[model samples]
Target: MPYSITVNGAVREVDVDPDTPLLWVIRDNLGLTGTKFGCGVAQCGACTVHVDGQPRRSCALPVSRLGNRQVTTIEGADGPEAKAVQAAWAARDVPQCGYCQSGQVMSAIALLREVKKPDDKAIDLAMNGNICRCATYVRIRAAIHDAAKALEA
Candidate 1:
């Protein structure tokens, strides 16, 4: 089946089964490899992407269900929040293995977009499922705070 979906501000076509996970389509069909596959069941946030500006787990989302919704992966993550998050991530040295950083960044950007100045509790609530193998939670929280501050300035 051929499905037409908007990704990264562009309409893209992919030929695959209706049940094919969006992650594979984004990575294999569209050649966008920023989204990672951690837990296929959606337990981990490695496959997090923005589906219509909301963070969604691409690993569990079926391509056919996308309809006309827009998908934003790490490759296409832009704008002020994205820049602030990326800068804060780099300045705080947030990534260790670097595998989960894409999803982490995606989640962080979404959170920052909704919450201008997220406290520790809000950060914890927002980044609940993104698991970093190297256990960089402290730095991740700090980076989110830093990004929030940068956005404030």
Candidate 2:
């Protein structure tokens, strides 16, 4: 089946099975590989993307289910909050192996979008789904706080 979906401000028509995960279509068909596939299951937030400005697990989201909603991958998250988070991540040296940073950053960006000054508990709740094998939780929390401060400034 051919499904038309708008991604990163571009409309693309991809031919694939209707049940195919949007992650594969974005990475394989559209060549947007920034959104990594870690666990394939939605348990790992490696395939997190913004569907209509909300973070969603692209790995489990079917391409056919996506109607006219816009999809924003890590490549397209360059807004003010995202930039602040990116800068904070760099300053805090958050990523160790850098494999899970994209998903981590995406989740963090979503959290910050909802909660500007999230405490440790809120951060933990919001970021629980994103599993980082490197176990950089301390640095990740610090970076989130730093990003919040940067946004306040």
The most accurate candidate by TM-score is 1
lDDT of 2 by residue, 45-102 (tens): 9899989988889999999899999999999897878999999999999888888888
Residue range with the least summed lDDT across 10 consecutive positions in model 2 = 95-104
Q: Candidate 1 residues 55-105, lDDT tens each? A: 999999999999999999999999999999999999998898999999999
In order, the Cα lDDT scores of the candidates are 0.96, 0.92
Clashing residue pair totals per candidate (backbone < 3 A): 0, 0
RMSD of 1: 0.5
Summing lDDT over every window of 10 consecutive residues in candidate 1, give the lowest-scoring window: 92-101
Q: Model 2 RMSD to the real structure?
A: 0.8
What is the overall TM-score of model 1 with all chains considered together?
0.99
For all predicted structures, in order, the TM-scores are: 0.99, 0.97
